[model samples]
Target: MRIIRAAKVLTGRQGEVIVDGEVLVDGSEIVSVGPRGSAGEAAEVVELPGHTVLPGLVDAHVHLGFDAKVDPVTRRSPESERHLLLRMAENARKLVSAGVTTARDLGARGFLDLALRDAIEEGLAVGPHIVAATRPITLTGGHCWYMGGEADDERAIRRVARENLRAGADCLKVMASGGMMTPGAAPSWVAQYTTEQLRAVVEEAEVRGKGVAAHAHAHAAIRSAVEAGVTTIEHCTFFTPSGHRFDAELADVVATSGTYVCPTVHGVMWRAREVYGPEMLDDWLRGIASMREAGLRLIAGTDSGFGAAGVDNPTDGFVASLEVFAQAGYGNAEIIELATVLAADACGVGEVTGTLAAGKWADLIAVAGDPLERLADLRNLALVLVSGRSVTQAGVDTVTASVG
Candidate 1:
């Protein structure tokens, strides 16, 4: 058993946090979490002089199979099986060190991610918890054409889903729209999927008891995916030929269907301004604002392997995302929720992992500043724990302890 006391414990739940709190962990579960001094005495106790603690962050969308190399996977040389395994382990460690204890891998090649997931669970290597999706189904010459196994018909998509399930996938991924990674492909907001195909993929995924993430960029594809019952929508970029606008009806449906909208906002918020120039910045901001206003379930994802600019640490990326939202004039509380409680909830593992509740896993992180005041505090993470075991720590003076 262990106890960690801190000046603040942001439970990562919406509206139920505390200042000067203590958390008790036994084995891998969070036995008790409450105000300071709640647990009389413990086997071990660590004090956070003035830092804040919160549940370990979750990146709802990632791709461990691809190394963050120069050319994106969908456009480059194929990775050797051995290389994929090795790279997956390295990516997981970086994520864990960033205080991202639980990550949902949206897509990965072959069966590498599945194997890595098992290895992490078995303690064969150092890594965070992995929720992996096997190879996704895609249309030929479509988004992520390489990693995606091209399948045009319902039978083909269903067949691919079953094969992925057989490969030990925890979830199913489908390329529902064109993506930026593939040259000559449609932009983030161009339509890519037929309503029938999305429906088929969703139905097959349901039958296998696996969740689906529709990689949607355009509104037409996004609407079709939501209507088809996807568990989450990735990179909802709101792109169109001329420009873009919110699909209000689709937004309402997503809010109504309880689907997760993982904007992976960090990627767009960082790149679009530099890539497209300033004229389209307002368009990008408005679309995101609309999604937030409609109360969609948004989560944080850096699209790390995509050469996503501006930051390195996933935790820092998450914090920067909140700041962008704040700068855009969102309420501080709402912006905070997008990275914490909302992110966990959107990933479909809220009950067991998101908050600092009794019986949940003790996945927590501590930082020196108050995120509620200046979002940058979140970037300066001090300590991180996964399953009650310390993965990284900040010294008394507030610097990350070296891994070695």
Candidate 2:
């Protein structure tokens, strides 16, 4: 049993912030969460005077096994897979230090994420719990095809979905349209997935009791995805013929279906544009704001991977997405929800995690100040506890288990 004292507790419920609160964790479950000093006796106790306790962040979209600094895929020569996985494990450690206790990978090559997931689960590594999408299915030569998915027909998609499940994938990812990372491809406009194929992918995953995450940027593909019962849409941008942009019918469909929309917003792209050139980043803000206004269920994702988007760093995206929400006129609570409650819900781990409510897993984070005041305050992270075990704490950023 352990008691974590905090200056305030952000219960992750909208507009709910309690000052001078605390949380008690025993084993892998949260025993109680309430006012600090009020939590009765415990085996161990610590004080975080200036810190705030929050439900550990849930990053809905991430790429664990890829680097985002360069054209990650192009830089990979098939021989560096092992090295890349090791580096990704290090990145996952950084993410855990930043208080991200749970993350869902949007896509990755082979079973790198699966291996990493097992490592973390089996106490062989220190990192966030991962709901990995081993490899996403894509049409031949379509977006992210470099990951080696060459499905162009319903049969192929079904086969790939089953293969991913057999590989212990927690979800199935499908590239339903073109994206910026895949250069020279159709710009988020041309839909690469037919409605029937999309349905097939979702149905197959459903029969196996798995979920589907669609990397859909175009409006047509987004609509097709919503109609087909996709669990989450990666971009959810409405790109039309002739580059006309608007979220169209997909918004209402998602609102009705309760599908999650992961913008995967990271500062790397915009920051890179400032250093590299404003050639891209166009319509990104517009797409995000439009989705927000449409009442779409928005979840946070960093799309951390090798190449054009992420730097393989998960913490960067977690903070960056909060800033994006702030810029879009969202309050602090709503912004937090995009990454926590909503995101965990997106990953199908809502019941087991997300809220600090009792009976849920003891996945929690503590910061030096209220995260709602300064989105960057999350960087003041002090302690991270996942499944009632401490992962990161002030001064000690990384931990290798001690042998008794």
Candidate 3:
């Protein structure tokens, strides 16, 4: 039994906050959470007098196989599977150390993500609880075709989807449009798959009690994904030949469908602004704000390990995403939810974790100060607990303890 007493506890339950609270944890599950003494005595008590404890963060979209510093396509094209898996294990450690308790590997090659997930579970490796999408379904020459998940027809799509599910994939990731990273492939605004094809993938996942995550960067692709009932839309950017085009009507349609959008803005503000230019970046932000106003649910995903500007620092990239939301006019509470409960729900694991509630996993973090008051406090992580096990700054195991 263990108790963590802190100056504030953001329950990750619809912006609820507990002042001077304590969380009782038994084994891997949280037993109770309330005012300081409400949890009573425990075998161990971790006191953080000037800190705040909140749900450990979630990153909805990540590609563990890709190295952020190198060109993903070039880096992985000839790399051995063993080498890629080892690099992925290292990436996972960095992610967990940065306070990301749950991460959904949106895309990966050869089901390496699944192996990494199993490794973490078996104590062979250290990483966040991973929701693996073994390999993303794409067109023969579509985006990320190198991942070896290309299906040219409906039959092939169904076959690949079933194969992935059979291989223990928790979800299915489908390429609905082209991407910026894959050169000579379809452009980002081009629709790679038809509505029927997208629907086929979604149907396969739904019947198997899984969800489909569509990689859509064009307006038409976004519409198709919404119509096909995808759980979340990755990089929901309305790209065009010239630049981006935000469609208000389509945004409203997406909002009505209750589909979550993962803009993957992590590293964008820092690295992409120069690459994408300020004008295009401004347009993207405006579209995001408009979508928020239209009731579209947005979740935080840094696109970590996907290579390029925004991903130089995978650990800090997750927190950088929250800053993007803040700049977009999101309140601190709302931003926190985007990274915690909302993100967990988007990744299909909200029931087990995401909040500081009884019966939930003890996946929370203690920071140097109240993040609710100043978002940057999140960067100053004092301790991170994933399922009641503590992982510190150095990625070393430790018992939960106070931070001065």
lDDT of each: 0.74, 0.78, 0.87
Query: What lDDT score goes with residue 325 in model 3?
Result: 88
Which RMSD does model 1 reach against the true structure?
A: 3.6
Q: Which 10-residue window in model 1 sums to the lowest lDDT?
A: 395-404
Measured on C-alpha atoms, candidate 1 has an lDDT of 0.74
TM-score of each: 0.89, 0.91, 0.95
Per-residue accuracy of model 1 over 1-404 as CA lDDT, tens digit each: 88888888877755767888998889788988889888778988988877888888887787777655445544446778897787777777777766677888887777788889898777675566777887878877767766756787788888888888887887888888887677776677776778888888878777877678899878888888888888889978667777766688778887888888887666345455775576666676677788878887777776666654332323224455556677566765566566666767666677778788899988888888777776677777777777776764332112222322
Span of 10 residues, lowest total lDDT, candidate 2: 395-404
Best by lDDT: 3
Q: What CA root-mean-square deviation does each model show from the true structure? A: 3.6, 3.2, 3.4
The better-scoring model by TM-score among 1 and 2 is 2
Segments in model 3 whose C-alpha atoms lie over 4 Å from true places: 75-77, 308-315, 394-404
Q: Which window of 10 residues has the lowest lDDT sum in candidate 3?
A: 395-404
lDDT of 3 by residue, 340-363 (tens): 999899989999988889999999
Regions of model 2 farther than 4 Å from truth: 183-187, 241-244, 273-282, 306-317, 393-404
Clashing pairs in 2: 67-305, 67-306, 68-310, 72-307
Please give the ranking of all candidate structures by TM-score, highest first, separated by commas. 3, 2, 1
